[model samples]
Target: MSDLPLDQVRTLLAVVDEQSFDRAAAVLHVTPSAVSQRVKALEQRLGRVLILRTKPVRLTGSGQVVVRFARQLTRLEEDTRAELGLVGAAEPVTLPIAVNADSLATWFLPALAAVPAVGSAPAVAFDLHSEDQDHTATLLREGLVMAAVTSAPNPVQGCTSARLGRMRYRAVASPAFVARWLTDRPLPEALPAAPAVLFGRKDELQDRFLRGLTRRGATGVRHFVPSSESFVDAVAAGLGWGMVPELQHRADELVDLAPDHPADVPLYWQQWKLDSPALATVAAAVVAAAATALRQ
Candidate 1:
C-alpha cells in the first residue's frame, strides 16, 4: 500500500476515463510523456499491465481492480469534502449509474426527479448509462458505474442488491398487424411466421416469449429496433409484433398474446457496499419509485 503512489494511480484512472494517454495528460494538466511514464511506473510497481493499446484503451482484469480502487478513492474524498463543508459550487459530486433502456424511458428518470441531489439541484451531477437490464450489473463489475438496475438478484462482489419489483411485458401488436398475421391462426403457430421486432441484435425477449408459448425460438422476418421508444413505436406502426413494456403507450388495443400470463422481469438495485450518503439517497429514491411503478 505504501509503495503505490497516488499520482500514478490517479493517472491510470485518468487514462482509462479519457480513453487516451494524451487526453489523460490534458485532464491532469501534465505532459503526455509524463502520463505515459506514470502509467508505466504504476504497472511496474503493481507487476501488471492495466490498459490495452486499443483506440479507446480497454482495461484488463487487473486494470479494472485498480480503476475501481481509484473511483472509490475519489468517492471517499468527495464525501469527506462534503462532510467538511469544503465543497463549493465549482465542483459537483458525481454519481455514475447504469440503468436499462426500458426503465430509463419510463420510471427511472422520474425516480431521479424526486431526488434533489442527483442532478442539477445540489452540487451534484449524474453520469447515467443505459444498458439492458440483464447486463447492467456488468458496469458495476467493470467499475464503470457506482450503481445499476439489473435483472440479477445476486449482488456483485462488494456490493448489495435490493429487489425493486418486476416490469411486466406483454406480447402485443397493432390491430392491423394482428389481423394481417396473428389472427389467421393460433398465436403459437402464427407468431413464428409473423414479422417480429427485437430490442437489438442481443434481444431475446420476443424469442423467449415465443419459446414460452411454442417451445421454440422466434423465426421468420425480424427487425431489430434498438431504441426503447422506437421498439414500441415500431410495433404500433405495424412494423412488427414484440414484447412491449406495460408502461409504454398502446396506440391500439393490444391483443395480449397470453392474457393469463405475462413476461415479468424482476429488477434489482445494485450498488457498491459503500458508506457514502449520496449512493444511499439515490438508492432510496429508486426503490420508492419502483414500488409505485412496478408490480410488487
Candidate 2:
C-alpha cells in the first residue's frame, strides 16, 4: 500500500476548500510555501497532477478524489469524537446540504424546524446551498455538501438515496396578459406569439410543457429571471407567461392558462453513506415534510 500522509491530504483539501493557496495557508496557520510544498508532495506520491493552479485554484479530477477523501476523513474524525464523548455535550451539529430554490421557498425551512429536539444539545445548524433540483447532486459529488434534494435517481458515489415525491407545475399568466395575447385563438398559435419568462437559460420545464401543448417547442422570445420568486413575479407582471410551482402561486393574481395540464417533476433526497446522527435527523424531517407537501 502506498503511504499517503494525512497532513498532505489535508493540505490539498484546504487548497480546494479555500480556493486559494494563500487563504488555505492562513487557515492552516502555515506559510503559503509550506502549503504549496505539501500539495506538491501529495501530487508526487499519488503520481498525478492534482490541482490546476489558477487564480482561485481548481481541482483536477484526481484532486476531486483526494478532496472527497479529505471531507470523509473529517466527518469520520468528528463522529469518533462524538462517540467517545470527547466533544462538549452542548455542541451544535452542522449539516451542510444542497436543495432546490423552489423547495427552499416552500417546504425546506419547515422540514428543518421539524427535526426532533435533542436534549440540551445546541440547535442543529444548516449550511444550505441552493440550486435547481436537476443540479443539486453536483454539490454532493464535489463533497461541497453532505446531502441534496435532486431530480436525479442515480446516487452520487458513497451516497444513499430515497424518492421524496413530485412537485407539480402549471403554466400560468396574468389574466390581462392572456386576454391581450391569447384570447380568440388556439393555445398553440397564441402561446408561440406571446412573450415568456424562464428560470434560466438551462431551464426547459416551461419549454417542455409548451411543447406538450402545442406539439412544437417554445419560441426564443423569452426573458431569463433565474430566481424562483423573480421568475414567478415576472410572469405575474406580464413580462411573459411561464410555468410556476403550484405552491408558490396562491397569494398571486396569476391565472393558470392550462389548469388541467400540469407537469409533475419527481424529487429525491440523497445523502452520504456515513451514519451521522445529525444527518439522520435532518433526513427524517425532510422526508416527513415532503410526504405532506409533495404529491406522492
Candidate 3:
C-alpha cells in the first residue's frame, strides 16, 4: 500500500478530537476550508469515508484506523524527540491507559507511582480511564488508550498481551443482610430472591455465581453501585450481597456467603506493539505490582 500522508492523518485526528472542522482549524491555525480539504483528500486517497460530519463528528471504521495510526505516529515522534533531547526536560509525557475500577481502587495507582524513570527518559503522567475489566479492551480497540488492564487474554488488533494474574472475588454479604434474607431456606433457594448489589449494568459476576449455584439468575431487586469503593460500602450497609474482590473485602463488615467457592478473574495487560520505552516502563511496573497484589 502507498504511504499515508502525515498531514492528512493528523488533520483527521484533529477533527475527531475537536468534533468540527472549524474547531480543528482553530487548533491547527488553519482555515476551516483547509481542514475540510485535508480530510476529504484523505478519504479520497483511502477510497473510504473516514468521518460522518454530524453535529459532533463521528468516525467511521476506516476513520478509527487512521486515527489510531495518527496517535501511534505522535507517540513515536514524541519518543524520538525526547531521546534526542529536543523536547523540554520539564515536560512529562502523558500516557492514556484504561483500567478496571477494582484494580484502580486497589493496586493500579501504586504501580504507576513505582515506575522509575529509565536513564535520561522523560517523566510520565497518567491519564487513566476507568472501565470494567471485561470492557477495557474496547478502549484499546477504539484507540482511546495506549494500554489497558483487561480480562481478555487475547490481544486487540495492533497490540500485544501478557497475563497479569487473577483477581479473586468471593460472594459476600453483611451479617444483618444474611440474618434477614438468607435464613429462610438453603442458599440456592434464598439467594435467587434476595436483594443483590451490582457494580454496574455490565457486571455479570453475581449473576454468574447465582447461575452456577441454582441454574438461574437473580430475580430480586438489583442495586447498582458503579464505584468500586461504594460497591463494597453498599454491600456492607446491607443494600445487597455482591461478589467482592479479595483485596477490598472487609471481614468486620462483610461475611463470605460462599467460603468454599470464589470467582477468579484472569487479568491481562494489553498494549500497543510499538517499542516505546515509556510504555515498557509502565507495563513492567504494573506486572510487578500485580505479582504481589493478585492471585498467581
Candidate 4:
C-alpha cells in the first residue's frame, strides 16, 4: 500500500482546484517550487503522473483519483472538526454537485432547502453543475462533482447510487398550437410537422417519444431553448410543443398532446461513498424531496 502523505494529497488537490501550480502555491501559502515538488512527489509515490503541465493545469486520469480522494478527505476532516467542536478556523463546506437542468428548475431546489441548517457546523454552500441527467454521471466519474442527479442506475466508481424516483414528462403545447397542428391530425403525423422545443441536442425525450410512436425523428420547426425554466415557457408561449416535466407543466394553459404517452425518466442520486455528515444530510433531504415531487 502506498502510504501517501496527507499534505502531498492536499497539494495535488490545491493545484487542480486552482488550475495552476502558481495559484496553488498562493492558496497553500507556499512557494511555487514547493507546490510542484509536493505534487511530483505524490505522483512518484502513486507511480503515475497526476497532472498535465498546461496553461491551466489539467488533471490526468490518475490525477482525478487523487483529487477525488483529497476532496473526500477534506470533507471528512471538516466534518470531524465540526463534530468535535474544533471548527473555530475552518472554512465553509462547499459541495460541488451535478444535477439535470429540469430538476434544477424544479424540485431539486426544494431538496437543497430541505437540508436542515446545522448550527455550529460549517456553513454549507452548493456549486451546482447543470447538466443533462443522461450525462451527469460523467461529472461524478471525472471527479468534477461529489454527487449527481443521473439517469444511470449504476454508481460511479467510489460512489453510491440511490433511486430518487421517476420524473414524468407530459407532452404539452399551447391550446392554440394544438388546435392548429394537432386537432385533426394523427399524433405521429402532426407531431413531426409541428414545432417542437428541445432543451438541447442531447435531449432525446421528444425524439424518443416521436420515434416510439411513429418510428420517425422530430424534424419540424424546432427551437433550442437550453434553460429548463424557459423551456416550458417556450412551449407555453406557442413556440413549440415539448415534453415538459410534470413539476413544470403549467396545466391550465397547456394541453396534452398525448396524455397516455407520458415519459417517466427514472432519476438516481449518486454520491461519493463517504461518511461525511453533511453529505449524508444532503442525500437524505434530496431523496425525501424527490419522493414527494416524483412518481414513486
Estimated TM-score for each candidate: 0.94, 0.91, 0.92, 0.87
The CA lDDT at 110 in model 3 is 91
Question: What is the TM-score (0 to 1) of candidate 4?
Answer: 0.87
Top candidate when judged by TM-score against the true structure:
1
Clashing pairs in 3: none
lDDT of 2: 0.85
Whole-structure CA lDDT of model 1: 0.87
Could you give candidate 4's per-residue lDDT for residues 32-129 as a string of tens digits? 99998998888888889889999987888888887888888888888887788776544567788999999999899988876755323456778899
Better of 2 and 3 by lDDT: 3
Highest lDDT among the candidates is held by which one?
3
lDDT of 2 at 273: 92
Q: Is 2 or 4 the stronger prediction by TM-score?
A: 2
Ranking by lDDT: 3, 4, 1, 2
Candidate with better TM-score, 1 vs 2: 1
lDDT score of residue 221 within candidate 3: 95
Candidate 4 accuracy as lDDT: 0.88
TM-score order, best first, reads 1, 3, 2, 4
Looking at model 2, the pairs that clash are none
lDDT of 2 by residue, 156-212 (tens): 989999999999998889988989898989888889778999888778788789778
Q: Write candidate 1's Cα lDDT for 1-296 as tens digits.
A: 54679999899989987889999999999999999999999899889898897998988999888888888888888988887878887877899899999999999999987887453333557899988888899889988889999999999998999999999998888888889998877888988888998888767777778888899776679998889999988988889888999998583556666777589999999999988877777888899999999999
The CA lDDT of each predicted structure is 0.87, 0.85, 0.90, 0.88
